[model samples]
Target: MQIYKVGGAVRDRLLERPISEVDWVVVGASAEELLAQGFRPVGADFPVFLHPKTGEEYALARTERKSGRGYGGFTFHASPEVTLEEDLLRRDLTINAMAEDAGGRLIDPCQGQRDLQEKWLRHVSPAFAEDPLRVLRVARFAARYAPLGFRIAPETLALMRQLAESGELQALTAERSWKEISRALMEPRPDVFIRTLHDCGALRELLPEVDALFGVPQPAAHHPEIDTGEHVLAVLRQCAEHAQPLAVRWACLLHDLGKGMTPAEEWPRHIAHERKGLKPIRAVNTRCKAPRDCQELALLVGEYHSHGHRALELRPSTLLELLQCFDVYRRPQRFEEFIAACEMDARGRLGLEQRDYPQAGYLRGAAAAVRAVTVQPLLERGLEGAALGEALKRERLRALETYKAEALGEPSDPPETPRP
Candidate 1:
């Protein structure tokens, strides 16, 4: 029952990266043998155990056979006879197939170390195409290591393309697909994830809404990038550069869906794209089973990002309506995320990456100004019921008006007299 530190722990250590978790592969070990030694069984489909003291996972060295469809369609065989080399052969990427002995000696049966040094994300074997999930996993790894100049091997990419065209990607469950997408979005080069998927034809199967944006044209004056798809990728890059949170990044990715639906006759001008985008955004959110926060923010950004870009020019009533739409009073943190997404969009255009986006600060100031106006003041003035709601609205509007006036260096409008 020899245990070897394996998979990500070994790969990251070799790359001088911070290891987050350690997994052990136990060779020449049976499930009964592990259970007798105090290891808790955790895997439902395979023989994986948890260490009683360390709580880390220890999966018995096993091999898999494709039995059906999708990623879950696999039969696993784990026993005392499974060899470490055979187990590694079943892994998706060569970089992740290597392991380390208990004495810290490297194990590289698949030439993973050489591939790592050469900055390649190569598949361990032709068996890689058996699991559809590997396509997403490889794209995610590309996003993670793109900063280190790592790229997917051409042959591996060909396999990914074959998988994409094999109708297997459609068999992937929403939860599994979203798990890869959400993790990829958090990586340093999330744009590359989308690009890699697009290159291998997976994006069209998984996210046709986003894939359609590739050839869509936009006004070159406003979007020097011209291509709506490229602009979206640029926005993702900006989100990464600013270290924005997941919700913000997700919103940025879907914010331009309406532009893809624009008529070619309409060309560069998508007059009411914000309204047009809401349908696709909702479809994507539902399909991905996105978190409520992520879905809500994406919907808001998709429907009103143009409003955010036009913050300074909007009337106080429009500004207040936008705030209400975001429920800024109830969820100020989400409002901040919304603002971050808008800023990324504004900076995402070609040659405007460093341009200032005052809209974010302006919207934040508006939220702060309205938050400063309390319903208590109206209640203290003998207001009640429907009248109280009206009075609060009036006060917030006046506050927003004043805030906008101050921001623009203009004379303030006189406050409306309180109704009797």
Candidate 2:
């Protein structure tokens, strides 16, 4: 049997990018033969084996035919007769269809190298439309490589648009779609992913909540970009530029969903959109089975991002209420992520990218200021039960008031003591 490294490892190596993992394809070998050689059989639907020593995956070269629909609707054939060219031809993208031999000889039966040099994301065959998930995969690949100047071939883009209009995207499982989305959001140019999907008509099918924002207008005074969709992309770009975590990036993505629902007569004004966004944000979270932290933070940002921007001007009581809502004393990390998302939103506007976001620092300091007030001191003062809770609240409120004064550059005014 001849083993050759295939797919991403070869593609990334050729692009001079760091290779994270290597996949091997064993040609001219049967599953029984590999098992006899101590390769562990691990694939359930197809013939995939684990190396006896390194444990890297080694699958027999195979080809597939569309047997049904969606991502799971496929029939596979793997045998000693399947040629490496046949296997590579079935891949989704040309750049991912190349393989390498043990002697360092390159295999490019699909002209993957030529496509890579041309910075094109071209499909290997027309059969690419057979698998609906390729729409998402192509968008993700665009996100990953767009920073390197890669663009989807017009012909391939037409194929993608056809698949998107085929009504097959709705058949994809929520978990699988979220997997592609989360990965794309973490890429260096994730905005390209959204724009690519929208350009090919897949965004409307898969994420209508986001697509609706495309033509919606925003107040130019605050958002010079005017279009809410453009603002969302800008936020995603800022998140990536800052290297923010997945939770923050996703939050920024969903932060303005409510703006899409605003009345046309209310053009350029979306008052209360923050609270109005909670439903769509929750819908997205529940559909994707997003992690609790991500869901909670997205909801928090959607409901309070405007509040975050107006932080310095809020009443001391309102500021305290905001901190209490986030439970900043208990989950400081979540509050920090909330601040990061808000910062991305504030900086995402046109001509505001490099502008200061003092709200982030102000809110962070507010959280820290309250966190510095402990219940231990109250407990030491012979306080207990409801009285102890009351004392802690008062102390924290007092601390926030002082912080507000400092942030506003005003004289410190001590809060009145609560009667016990």
Tens-place lDDT digits, model 2, residues 216-250: 99877778899999999999999999999999998
lDDT of 1 by residue, 207-289 (tens): 99999999898877678788999999999999999999999999999998988889899988887888899999999999999
* TM-score for each candidate, following the candidate numbering: 0.96, 0.96
**Alpha-carbon RMSD of each model:** 4.7, 4.5
Q: What is the lDDT of residue 300 in candidate 2?
A: 94
The segments of candidate 1 whose C-alpha lies over 4 angstroms from its true place after superposition are 410-420
lDDT, candidates in the order shown: 0.91, 0.90
At residue 9, give the lDDT of candidate 1: 93
TM-score, candidate number 2: 0.96
